[model samples]
Target chain A: MSDSPDSAKKKILLIDDEPFITSLMAMNLEDSGRYEVREQNDSLKALETIMDFVPDLVVLDVMMPDLDGADIIYRLKNDARLKHIAVVFHTATVREAELHAHGGIISGFPFLAKPATTDQMIEFIEKHLPK
Target chain B: MNSVPPDSPPPAQSTLQQLEEGGALSQFASSIAHEVCNPLSQIVLATDLLAGPQPMTDEFRKKIITFLRQGADRIEKAMKSMLQTCAPIETSMVAEDANVLIETALASLTVDASVRVEKHFASDLSSILIDKKHMTEAVAAIFANALDAMQPSGGTLTITTYAKVFTSSEREGWQRQSWFRAGDHAVVIEIADTGHGIHKSQMPLIFEAFYTTKVAGKGAGLGLTVAKKVVDLHHGRLEIDNRPEGGVLAVLTLKSAAKPATFLSQPLP
Candidate 1:
């Protein structure tokens, strides 16, 4: 294994049911040169992909069938192995105020709204990722 | 008007005042709540499931919270309307800045990143006397309806304000019944969206209470009705025109204090 930090890239796991948004985020994140992106479109298979990828950061979409994003967070928080990884939420369910109120339990986790600009998405990922 | 005997007491005498009034208001509130509750309930159940002990991983919690927040916001709006209608007015009415109100309401919208929100405020326009809360709600309701008509596809929304003059004679039906005076100053705000225009037949019942074309559980048809009530409270006029380019144009006209009289405003044909 190469021990050089310069050549190594941080991987990111994206779990979203929507192909459009997920693909858009993946493309933008990949272009940012800071992340290696792995996507899981279905929430049910999200854990397997996360476990396999062991990403440095996780970006989750809220509205999914079987295994939604919030549940994924609860599980990640409890799992000691995955607990250290940073998480960012991307959703368009409500405005900022409502999100702020409901984001009470998920301290320190970053959030980005859907249909966001590439710059906005990149900024979120950069801010939440460990240096 | 003379059908009732001159010695007869008012209708209040025949009905139990508190029971009747409270019953009617509660029914209206319950109906509105019922309409909003469907979506809200889905969110709550979804949130509860997300919060359950079944183990939600780090990847999924954010999404569940978003759904719950949105659902709560919807219910809050409905509850706000109910409270506004049921509670007695305590604040004095005054001239309010239409531009400010519209901007405040638009800020709450979850406009897609692709969609651009544009506003054109008339600098010389006079302010209209109205309740700030109700006026804001009415304008917001119109904008919300417009957004629903244009969401996902993402398009530009233009809200414009202007000052105009209208004579009472030009206004008819409800306007005439309400005794709109000639030479009244009028302030108009138009919210134009880029979406599928309203159908012709739907126009007739657009303002009718409990009338909506939205899919079942999507809307209670109270948006326009509550909006109309707010407009009535402000002595204003609300009009919806289907634009040829494919969208709904909502025009809100409120009485202003100073404008030279022109042709009477024509009612919707």
Candidate 2:
């Protein structure tokens, strides 16, 4: 039997402090069959997980304990090995209307406001995924 | 002829009042929105999974239902906390021992065994006019915050009560705050904790509703807000500052119901 083109799924890493959120999101994305999802609930260990997983894309929550999304982005951008991976912020820190007004981009980075529909998240992920 | 109404406040005062009210309303609304978003996100995601095209096992179904319930419960809890904090307090003031109130507050909480509590109540401490129930809640809130700061590393929680007569110099130092007058006898209750002190930048917003350093689900961020409100209703002053020797100290000063004796003459319990 020959392998299908869709069988090679894109790898996505989700970093959020909320366990339920990461769990539900991973399940939903993996169910779609277009992606393989990994969840990291600890923001402190996010970098280590990213390095080991080497996911194609990373979705992070903005407000986290110890280290925040921006701090992680700074570290990622500074590190040559991790700089090339795509990053998107999934946050509840900003209002959904504000996110929309900014065209889903905050501080020169892609953003998806919390309570977003699965379609919206998938669309955002697809749009921001590295080509 | 004057165009402004005779009973109206001065233009500058009115403007300042407006600004203060507007700022409070804005902060409250923003806090509610932000706090609700986390639970809402969970609900949306959970529902999305339930409606997904994937085959659902019995385990997955049970998990999703649990997630939905958890999310709903969180939202309900946050709303209840917000309402309780924002509600207008109806206080019945009476002369009560400050130490008793602190004890009452402490008794209500389940203080961890790792945290040691020390009380240094003044033998000559005067009773203060307070709504006992509300004041106890305020003190408990402060205690809770102190404990939270210590977290996994428990520390000593020191509570001290003393009485003082505010002198003209002290009044001037406080910028003639309406809460106290010169020569007024006041009882001071200090709740100090040997925990990581709050950051200087965050001190201004600490009392603001839903402004918390704790991770989501750990708090609704209304504890200090409610505490401050209760103190304000009693015309008392509540000040929280980082102690020099480490940790944070919360000083609550309320008007003494009776003439306070010379605290220097009394022995500490």
Candidate 3:
């Protein structure tokens, strides 16, 4: 919100099939003035959006129809340009209980369950992103 | 006519049976949870935004409130459909015959003329308490699967209707180790086909929501789920097995209407 022309603002991409969740996260992150955010509902268009936005962090959903988060991450890992982009799987596909059951880890990344408060999502981003 | 006694509770079933039922329900609930949570997450964020220390004009506050209300209504609508699928149909249960129900389901199917239709209904088959429309749809779903399995090449669709008392253990044994209730006087409907049989491993997973072996667009994987739910609601069970020689045999059992009591009275001299 503040136009201070600071380079410190982190760029974040929120991708999920649910448009409402993306909108909510986008609004919260943008309002904080701490991140430049892009929201993509269609996972197939995720790469195109990433190319256009070139975000610092990506919040990917795992159960998307066009492409699952794991597949997207695999593609990202293969590509040099997008390989460095940090991703946190925020989804209902692998629930919180499942992660806990498996000793608190899934896909070797910080995971956040759906119906999460904005604070929890922001906290995860802050922890993962370089200060 | 006998009614369920007011003070008497229905007999308790095995934990295994309960577990199977729970699995079916939890699978369905997970789908609902995802849909419901999407809207719920929005409401949580919008409310947070409004309640936060950020300065907002009255118009903006109104907008946020509108989104909140919309999210709430969306959750309600999703939950209503979820409940509708699983809820008992109190008024629709009537004393209906299984033979008639099977015929009605068969008639509704869009089967090719080459597919042979065979019906063997017992003459004295007892009436069942069921919702006619749903029961028909459930049978229709099984038939749809049979038709798919034997596609292009035709097959015999042998449907047999008979009445029998099956103990819970017997139903369990019949499935070559499976699960269901203990005892019931049910009008059993067995629909057999001559098509390729189901893979044994996939049998248990078939009732699970979204567990589909069919190619995409050909199936939503809800047919068997709906059938199971319907049978459960009608106080019955559904079993699908591979026939020894070939193809699949799907058996549906529904509790029959209670037989009238015949009383003997002393005659006056």
Candidate 4:
């Protein structure tokens, strides 16, 4: 019943408190023609949006107002229906040097420092998205 | 009973050394990098889209250009705020009306229309010795923080100024310094906002450099730190606490230049 990989655009949901970052990243990913992108600017509503969108992967920001990336991940992992979705942190809270020192993993999740190019984002998505 | 000998020299650790040892400097550096990176991320993505092979419409091109400019402006703003927070502030002290300074600070900001400003100034308020420009900046910073908290769904901002004689009990609550005494006359400026109050856990960290509860790219998180520095330069006390009903209350107390008997005899009505 599943669509073929070539026919289906990969769904990627980006959750960041900054509208500018989310809007820019969404445009960049959509322009590639290989992915479908949705952005959630409010961390509090991120969980509900993620469940509704049913994205293949979620790119999250670490620091937000009410809810943070870690908290969202915790919620996702706790949910039986949502735990299977792939997740990665894209945050400015940690320095690039710190990410490198930690071998690109933070709190047991794949991580990307901010100021990353669209190419870097696509590369990370391709490497992590489940087949 | 255990204390350094009265004749003993103070510890040799400089403020910079202490900051470095405590990892404050590293934290400060990381915060600055974080602030810059948020805008830099947008810039990178915007430029990449512009350079990509995909056909771009005129509307999309204009949007990308706007974002590029916004990102650059954010970076410039962050750099300027950081410099203002860290640089040594030169102050020229003069006797000025607290009400005038508050009004001047308010005039500098473009406040939202939804937010109502209520001023309750004392008619017999005493004049305070302060650097008018620096004090205005300090007051404006506090006002800015209040306004930020009440954004989108605006609220009330209440400002009150009065003269007082610091009692022993009140002096104990403020910073312990030789410059201010229990009987000293002072002018008090209280700015209260009707917005979501700060969490109890965050109370201690609110004054720390680069500590902010706001979303990234909105601010550099140096407003309170700079405000505190300005108050310190004037040998004054600044205190912030959550209000009982709701929101936050910031109090700025400065030594008054007017005679205590004159100002205190006629209390604020």
TM-score for chain B of all predictions: 0.63, 0.86, 0.63, 0.80
Whole-model Cα lDDT of every candidate shown, in order: 0.63, 0.80, 0.71, 0.81
Q: Candidate 3's residue-wise lDDT over A6-71, tens digit each?
A: 487888999887776788788887777788888998788988888888888889886555465766
**Model 1 lDDT vs. the true structure?**
0.63
TM-score pick, better of 1 and 3: 3
Q: What lDDT does candidate 4 reach at residue A37?
A: 89
Q: Candidate 1 chain B — worst ten consecutive residues by lDDT sum? A: B8-17
Report the CA-based lDDT of candidate 2 relative to the real structure.
0.80
- For model 3, residues B125-194, the per-residue Cα lDDT tens digits are 6677666787788889889988877777888889898877666555433332233345546678998988
RMSD of 1: 16.8
The alpha-carbon deviation from the true structure for residue B103 of candidate 1, after best TM-score superposition, in angstroms, is 1.9
What is the lDDT for B106 in model 4? Answer: 100
- Evaluated on CA atoms against the true complex, candidate 2 attains a DockQ of 0.57
Using DockQ, give the best candidate's number: 4
Ranking by TM-score: 2, 4, 3, 1
Report lDDT (Cα) of residue B136, candidate 1. Answer: 73
TM-score of the A chain in model 4: 0.85
How high a TM-score does candidate 3 get? 0.55
CAPRI quality of model 2: medium
Candidates 3 and 4 compared: the better one by DockQ is 4
Best by lDDT: 4
Clashing pairs in 3: B168-B182
User: Candidate 1 DockQ score?
Assistant: 0.02
Report the C-alpha displacement of residue A62, candidate 3, in angstroms. Answer: 3.1
